[model samples]
Target: MSDNDNRGDKPQGPDNGGNGGGGSNPWMKSLLIWVGILLALAIFVTMFDGRAATTGGNTIAYSAFLDKVDEGTVKDVNISRDMISGTLSSGEKFKAYPIPDSTLVPKLRDKGVAISAKPEEGPSMLMLLLYQSLPFLLFLGIAFFVLKQMQKNSGSGAMGFGKSRAKMLTQKEGKVTFADVAGIDEAREELEEIVEFLKDPTKFARLGGKIPKGALLVGSPGTGKTLLARAIAGEAGVPFFTISGSDFVEMFVGVGASRVRDMFEQAKKSAPCIVFIDEIDAVGRHRGAGLGNGNDEREQTLNQLLVEMDGFEANEGIIIIAATNRPDVLDPALLRPGRFDRQVVVPRPDIEGRIKILEVHMKKVPLAPDVDARVIARGTPGFSGADLANLVNEAALTGARKGKRLVAMAEFEEAKDKVMMGAERRSMVMTDDEKRMTAYHEAGHAVVAMHEHASDPIHKATIIPRGRALGMVMRLPERDSYSYHRDKMYANLAVSMGGRVAEEVIFGYDKVSSGASGDIQYATGLARDMVTRWGMSDKVGPLEYGEPEGESFLGYSSSRPSRMSNATAQLIDDEIKRIVEGGLDRAKQVLSEHIDQLHTVAGALLEYETLTGDEIKKLIAGEDMDRPVPGAKVSSVPKAGTSIPKTRRPNGPFGSPTPLGA
Candidate 1:
């Protein structure tokens, strides 16, 4: 946590016992206000009652008061309309209400009792008005107090719906610099010129090279677009106005436009500043794309933004930086030459980039000496900067969970499995038969992938239930691969069919479970893509076919009216079937030829519930998999005898495939 966050947790008490300037504690202030209001009401009641001053005397009945007067015991009486106050001859004070009799007054005189007549004065009209309006005034005070608090907390008052929600980011929130950014060097380089323009615009203008008025950051999610913007702000050391695109939208027609005007007005006052609008696609989407008449609140806001960005008046010294993952949906006017002139693409990091990202995140973690960034980077092919950061975090969490002092490479491996495959489901229970079937199924995939020359090396195989799968076998490339060859595609198809083929060969065809549903879906998609998209099938010709209408990643593909006609559709299906069937036959032949080795791998999985590629290779070569693995400080090596000596890859057991015909 930051120091600001920590300071908020402690009390304001100090040696002087004064309230600290950081006064977010509202309850105390509210209590004082209420206490003052209550005291004022108390004083008002005391001043209005008048009877409170005469509260010391005892109250008596009217008959007793007259009797006292008749007995000449009453001294002097202060008589009002219905009540009388007096002191007895005994010198004690009393009050009473008397009957309305004219003769009583004369009788009082005969008794020599002193009588003073004064009618009780009712409250004045002004006092009555005050009494009636007090509750309403109290209610108004409460409402005003609430509104003031709202303004203080939200910066936007209760009705400030059209105010700009942009905030000026500063170093207090931990300023981000270019040194803190990694894994996307090209994107960083693209934005460095903007920082230069902000710092010294004359250097560029001397050569008649005007800096871009706006730069649009286009990238996939988690590709570090927003982080790059922050780095630019830190480098420039100028004012930065940051707001989300959603902040410029409202239900009212002109409210969004009003906010746009306000935001630009604020930006103009702080010239030479960068205004970053993240996810600009929210308000900058295509104007006429909607089903409505096309002029909506969002379009109006977009129109105002376009005019402000590149209107008749040049916004000199002010640069606009916007980011979006869906740049395809943005309006053309927003991306035209003068508005967002330069478009920068921030792609996912490559292997080298991943290594740099890992190093950056590793500084904050206590990593073991054996933790190699290259090894983790090679294991992760398509990971973005955000993903690499999460990998490091998950590794730390795994180490903490295991009660380890430092995060080790083993913890990273487990974290990789979690991020790539899914978390392990330890709570899932399986019967003995189910466990055996899963072991055999995964063993088939591992064995087939090991025997395929073009397929990637097997990383690990497990019968442990994870994610939605009862068992899974993962493969990782020796290095990142950008393109695929025909042999590699064929190998993938064959490897995908290994699990189903194993069940058919070991058990009966009827007993083969639905465990290979995912494999079938993957194979079908690859087959169709090979025939239609990649032009791999000569029978289907080199024509591009449109997307299959109702295809899902996990479900089968369905055909509909698309770019191809009915006859061409039937031919495409034929080519897909042929490719898939060929792969099926290849997997079946390989598994049948190595039936004994398949049992050995399956038996190991049944015993260990999981096995690495190196262990599987050892098991296939008749070596003891129970021996110490690589990188372990072992005193000795285990011996093994093999009927056929084999040369295997040292780190991973792959790249040696026997020809099917041979």
Candidate 2:
């Protein structure tokens, strides 16, 4: 099992790269130092020039120029009252002024031929220098800092072209082991071999078996792909290099490729290590197929990755593990032999798996003894590992909010409902008539599920508004099963249409409701699949309509086939219609046979706002009915008191009040 499957320790941040404190870039520091020096020079120039403010004119230079002009032999002289004067030198008059003693003493002894200075009131050269240079310097400093900050925030340094963006977690950092990862037994078994290979590569080498170059973990997000990779690192006790696929791409063209190279180099240095790339499809997408110019930086990075995986010397202990939900979108070359040769599917957890996941996450959380993880798992059919973990956390929060000390079974059920539908909109005001109608609609669904379908049982039926629905009837499978039988599909369709069927039978017509829109869509889809895909209808025979040619954008064909003759197409359409009408008829017939019971259940639903499968069973079997045979327990009803009566069977009449004695 992968180390991530274990939940022995808390997750820690990445290790400090040998350099020490938090890994700041030396280049950034050097750039900041250069900026500081320039800023200091600018400040010094401004401070010394404060003297030139009051003494308007070129203070030092003007005084010195006048000293030279005064000391020279004057043949011709010109002066104006406005302070415009000329220096007489060799019978030629030039503009001049009196020299100050401070300037004359130094220049006469220093350099000859000094220029004249005038007391013209204007801004000083130093003041102009300060005015112009300061803004430019300020702009330069600001721009430098902003760009540097942006680079740092982007997980790379400014001009960090060659650096790898992969986050490294040493063995000491990750505490999660195989025990934490639950539910994905197949994925764990496959990863266990990887751990074994990493621990002792020579064992395989002795048998002339080569370790897989890479393993691609493909599944939906939140299925613990990255966590599984971390588990491998923990188990193998090696450094784990982690990076997102998007980390490779930047505005620069070849930078992504450079980053890929750097990452591989680092992984090689760590030798007996694992490199986990999350969401690898971000870079490994099918090349030359995007809307923009055919040239893609991501494709280049992917190509470089291929080369790195194959071209380099086959290091015995190094392994590459990548994860992506959209594995179908990845480059074909990347999936070829020797590069991601093995694909492990991290599917959503089954009932047993979910229970195990719950047990793992529930360890830290204070849970009531009555809380059963299996019950919670059965309630959530399609929950992933992350979803199960979230359910536990949500249950804990719900418990705390209700002033409870520990998470109880009731809180878990509430959390499951919240996760499946949404938060209950208790604030949504419904009139008496509307509430009654919603109750009938939901009860209709529950009744059909209870009577018509023996495989899938009604979990809960509620008139409470949640998300886009005014009411909802949740039906869960008796157990986790992969392949759906034809009978089950037909039964599901009937249950889906139960709402509309009941409305027609009870009110003589259907009342158009936004709530039933999703149900209707589901029912119609199932009927269409029965005719075209599943071939459940006699008219369609046992032949599939066949999947469409080329890739479908929504994973289903939007355009109908144009090749078939009109008559044949009409037959197909009629067959689809017949299948749907037949299912609806079955639904109506079932609801009609138990019309009185449906009303009873609907009435209870209106009063209670929610009913478990047992409650529905009670209303259907009449007041004096015995407990039904065991099937599947849907949602649990709140116990009447501290003691849950033994009369509460898995599949039994609902609201069977607690027995007086036991």
Candidate 3:
């Protein structure tokens, strides 16, 4: 391999020179140099001043002529021996023994005085300074690098906190334009102007018109309030800022208000943008009204929101959209003409609207060729867009579970049943006797509702367990209605009482189940409303009795001092009892008249476990039941378009019923 290839394969590092500086730490190099220099200086000093002598045995005798006595040696020399003669250093001659060089050599070595014939090498002085300072220099460098990194990260960290948390989607995300939002045709008309303004704001501004400051989307939950806002963004092709009302709140006192300001600031920067706030009721609730602490953090947030919304210098290019299910609880100031200038109500889809919603959701799913969206729509009377979408998805899932490629009609039917009655409880055990009793109870409700309440016909009847009920009988209006008349109320009460009345009539006594508890409560409430609130009681003389007596000493009162006194109160109670008892009696009478048919229907329920309204009618009148009764016109059943004509007839199936006055 070439030198270039070898270099690439080998790991490399920095090189240092060999004054103990070659690949050596500066501090260690310096220490080695200093120790070498000290050793060299000690060797030179030992060479100049040498001491040498030799001895044998314990003593040595030295006889020499008297040499010149050095002044340095004569001053302190004195010798003495036991049993031998010695001389003192006062010019007196005497014999003496001296120590040996062997002992002296060890003494000199202990005092760091060694004698060597050859000299040793020593370290350099410059290497010592580098060795002493290298560790502190390396430590300072490391700390400087770490602090710089920390400062860089802290500066960049601020960018993340200031960025808006809203997720932005372009045209590629999904196609849910204004065309897909159906049912609320009127609402769509109102929002179209917004799309126009967004498309060309200068057009409206040139004519001296300002876009609406804000629009409030008010509706029940699941009614596509949020969907409409998204559609507006998609149609306008503008950046959409979406947030929930709760997002503005935080533990800090002014965090919510600060967030409101920040949100508007962001929106202003992105001019011609839509800012959608879902569930606005969280912070926009009526000011000065809330439970608990009462310091009102939500109110402060709402106040900031109001100021930002209306106090902006130039709001021509920005549009605000807010949604709330509880429009009733919002502050009046927030909804005034200048603020949420347009209030669009997105109500539950009507039948035609539901069909359109079904069409929209059915696009992606593989539905059977024979499936009819209109039929599904008719089956679902009060369904919203979200519910319809869920229905389609659920139906598709049901088909997939059955190992089918496309959703069949049967799958859709099952999904609808699941949505309406709740999931089936095959594990819900019931005794044969209990099942029979449930059948009879449900049959009683269906038969009376079908025969008496021509306006409220039986939709379906079943003895199968669903939700909390062992049996259920569904009654639906003949058509979509916005108002309920007095007769309809009385008919509803009679239907509600049918189950207990049938149990009483057939068994010659009452065997009520807790399942009828809700029914009883509903009936009782209607009776009270008739007497107290509706003034349906003749004794009460067309005066509402349930009106609240405001600002009383003992809080709100349900009753007021009447001119009729105590006896009249007694009469009112009697009238309420009479009205409720009359409903129960009428239900019993209707069930008795068709006693055999009721048993037949109940027996069928025990066999099939469920039956539709049409099926129950077949069981009631046999094959001939499809035709009207002889000499009794079906005219009492109002036609599709006409109003239910007021006529006082008999108190039987054909009677003109009246709601009990509350």
Candidate 4:
């Protein structure tokens, strides 16, 4: 309680001391108003006090007064050394002042006028007191008001520096219940018991079962960890305090710790509440990972958090829920029992979960009859709930752009393409040679992917530029897969190398463009991983040689791996090069076997600019389709009005190719 609050309770009627915790403080307002009035009064008295007193009389010149005295018109008189005053027989009171002659007083006496000397007086004690003290008091009041205003505007004062900045949500505020969150059933179920504990502890307390003090939600970005926390609070219908881990950390040495203490204190007041800390890895990183001395603020904050959790009784009803993607870097103590006792892993949603997530996000969108959530879910193997939501929003935007009333399957496909391969750069102009090369390159990828035993089915092939790629071939899985086998790895590498192989087969190796640079990098990484990490290399055996990343807060580098024997290192390099060479060989053989099909697909791409998996599969199956060839002379130089194959655009409905590798 504040000191002013204590004063408010003291029987001081109508003076709440500005501390009563409700509406505006009437007593403070009244006090301020009176201060303003007193200051104004002091100013008025200060300005007007030194002037001569004026009342009920007209003043005459000294000569006129002397003449009046000679005329015997003056009856009674009062005199001072510098000025004189008198009452005339005509019943008028007047004063004549600044008289240099001393004969005036005696003359008034000779005229039979009652005369007396008026005594000199100093300013009264009230005026003197106001003059001396009112200015100081006014200055003090203005300064105090300004400081108070500054404190209010800044949301804190020097004394309140240790207060927690966590935003408090009562039961009514955060209404995001479990029904609002989908795609993470396991995480939701894990937290359901926590909510039950908050709702009523006696059921568990009778069995001597103490509620877990904390649960850490670990997941990748956009995996809905924060949303899960909010749902728990909503289900429990209790007060909720949400704060970020970075909020606790400050430049001041003990500020973070102070905030932790203050936050705990607030939780205790609103007992049975949930305190959620998002992105806890910011402040919960491993201690001593900083500079030589380590970070005092974050460490201190973590220590205080540990103490707070340890001090809480089993039935305290305060649950600390935190979320972090980098759980590996968090301090061990933070993950130990009694503090973050349960670490719930929130993984990306699988196919079914993705379908449910899409359904939930689709509630607000006007989806067309053709839009199938299941089909989209099957295509999006690694989408999180947030990603699904974004996909639906993107689809809706695509539909709106085309002036459509409903979001259709075609729009969803375009949105998915935008999400995966990136937006198509239709404005980018490609030369005739580049266009032809891109068509052959992408067709090569489609053909190789179709033949690869472990590859997913081709969805679509396009020569239209997407993102940084000159062209792209999308291969989407029918269902999500958790692991890859050796054949699958080999197939992936071969598919990655197909573009360059196609270029080498069609045009000589010298004619191949640098467009295959990304493919080579991806294939090399895969090959290296197979040799060093996956144990696919027969010479390197099943040994894992990849170094784990270091977990230092200051981003300190780790020492190199123990040096391998020269022969062993050379063997590993040779195995990686051999794997890449094998993939290139596989791609070349596949392209050579189906040279006719490759040209056919490339011709179709040059004509349509895009082909669905069904269309490509039909063409590959030897269906005689009308295929357009790039640079095929129509009449020597084509007429200006003649249709250029690459210039023809896809219909406006989708306007972009879908993600499918035929």
> Using TM-score as the measure, which candidate wins?
1
Q: Rank the candidates by lDDT, best first.
A: 1, 4, 2, 3
lDDT, candidates in the order shown: 0.78, 0.69, 0.66, 0.76
Alpha-carbon RMSD, each predicted model: 9.3, 12.4, 20.6, 12.0
Compared with the true structure, model 4 gives a TM-score of 0.76
lDDT of 4 at 519: 85
Candidate 1, residues 273-338: lDDT per residue as tens digits?
A: 889998999999877766578678999999999988999978877788999989877888999989
Off by over 4 Å in 3: 1-169, 291-295, 312-314, 531-576, 624-662
The reply for model 4, stretches above 4 Å from the true place, is 1-155, 171-174, 311-315, 552-560, 624-662
lDDT of 2 by residue, 1-662 (tens): 00000011112223332212343576678677778868777776767677445322222244444554566643322323233233445544344334434554354434444334444456689876876787677678768877876676554665776578887765544477898788899999999998898778889999899888899999877788878887886787777777888889888788899998888888888787888887888888777766677567877788889888987666556688999889778789999888887999988887888889889889989988999877877777777777777778889999999999988888998988887777899998998767766776777787778877444777777888876678888777767778878777767767776777555445433343555677767767766776667767676677667456544554666456656567766777787666665566666667656766666777677667777777677667765324332221112222111222222124752243221111
Residue pairs in steric clash, candidate 4? 458-660, 458-661, 458-662, 459-660, 459-661, 460-660, 474-660, 474-661
lDDT of 3 by residue, 232-315 (tens): 877888877777788777675776887777777778888878888888988887765545565667888899888888875555
The C-alpha stretches of model 2 lying farther than 4 A from their native spots are 1-158, 170-174, 288-294, 312-317, 510-514, 546-558, 561-566, 624-662
Q: Give residue 550's error in model 3 in angstroms.
A: 14
Candidate 4 global lDDT: 0.76
Among all windows of ten consecutive residues in candidate 4, which has the lowest summed lDDT? 1-10
Number of clashing pairs per prediction, in order: 0, 19, 19, 8
